[model samples]
Target: MSESIDIVYEALGRYIDGLCGSTYIGTARGMVVLYRGAEIHHLTPLKEPLPFLNLFYRKGTVEIVGVWREEKSEAFFLRAAAADVRLFEDERTISIITYPRTGDMQERGMLIITLHANMGMAKTLKSIIQEETRFIKKEEVVISSRVSI
Candidate 1:
């Protein structure tokens, strides 16, 4: 199963690179590695994969967070409008919130990504949603005065 997961991750990396023309970064255990056309970022064991959530976004950026098997869990959330990515853990779930990006209307758009994992699969399940928030427009008021102040 771990081998299959590795293949899946490799395929995912290739797919992402092909789609965005950006390099893919992967981690396992505690090491980090980068993948390009025919190159590898690191050669040492430190380049090995990690057992946590890996996030890919904005062409060449990847973020990873640690997870405890017995204590807590980790997940990734993305906000497209703000070009923001969030790493949420079990302890911080209450403080988790998504906001709009500056220079844009507060209700413009949002894209959310959530990841979940189990014990045996060695894979993560991702859920994505694209949505728009609507706001009511306010109209200016005009006052008329008949005769005199």
Candidate 2:
């Protein structure tokens, strides 16, 4: 496998060593899993890169939601769902700022992992999103700085 592939897989799979799916039945699905939990996460891509993202706050963003559970089935990463994957920072957890294609927002429109899981879960989801985003997005450098004496 390519080094980048190894790098990404290793980084994401760091926590999977203790989780489920350690058995060897195969089932035709891939053996590697990054983070598996009760929550079902949705993933999307950014067509255009964001202008800037501060490093300290940008770590631990998840890109691919979950692993493919079956062989012939491909994990569908939604491109159009970009609009629904907005991030809203809360006191502890980052709420997935989702919206329907039409109509108004309702009680059934949002999702959160709770405060205790802010980093454990929310950060993983965010990290997956960020990593995949970085892999696909071209690097762009912005210059210009002001000097104050």
Candidate 3:
């Protein structure tokens, strides 16, 4: 049997809107890439970002963290919000795959995610995503994030 996957696209779009001087979150769906090996995958049949955000939201706040690319362990906790999640040569992308503390069979397949930003906001968003480049494992990474910077 093939399992269904819930994809996140709009929240990141909204977040990008917020960054782009929009008072309201626009309807544009954010750009996200999911891939296996060198073949990029598309996220079809789009869904709202609320359900996905709800998974990590707590106490009226949600924390975004980046997992070290070399980490092979399947178990982990959301210890803290990462200062930056960018893990690509292109400054516009931010990796969003985090390791869960429990290896729930149901919560499978967050393998690789990288978010690409709009070219216009590249300068503004780059600083927020800036981090040490050595931690990035580009060749094997799949990326996802807001569509800014």
Could you report the Cα RMSD, in angstroms, for every candidate shown? 22.1, 17.7, 13.0
Q: TM-score of each candidate?
A: 0.24, 0.25, 0.27
| Least well predicted 10-residue stretch by lDDT in candidate 1 | 140-149
Candidate 1 local lDDT, residue 3? 40
Local distance difference test values of all predictions, in order? 0.28, 0.27, 0.29
Clashing pairs in 1: 27-49, 27-50, 28-49, 28-50, 29-49, 29-50, 29-51
lDDT of 3 by residue, 6-120 (tens): 1123334334433453322112223333333355443321333311211132222213222211212111112112232333435544345433222334432333333444443
Poorly placed runs, candidate 2 (over 4 Å): 1-83, 102-116, 133-149
lDDT (C-alpha) at residue 55 in model 1: 36
Error of 1 at 44 (Å): 38
Best-fitting candidate, scored by lDDT? 3
Lowest summed lDDT window (length 10), candidate 2: 140-149
Count clashes in each candidate, considering only residues at least 3 apart in sequence or on different chains: 7, 11, 10
Q: What is the lDDT of residue 134 in candidate 2?
A: 38
Report RMSD for candidate 3: 13.0
Global local distance difference test of model 3: 0.29
Residue 74 C-alpha lDDT in model 2: 20
Q: Residues 1-149, candidate 1, lDDT per residue (tens digit)?
A: 44434434444444454346532233234322323235443211222243443333222222233322222222221213212333343421211123324233533232222233332212221111111112121221111011000
Identify the runs in model 1 with alpha carbons over 4 angstroms from their true place: 1-20, 25-83, 91-104, 118-149
Number of the top-ranking candidate, with TM-score as the measure: 3
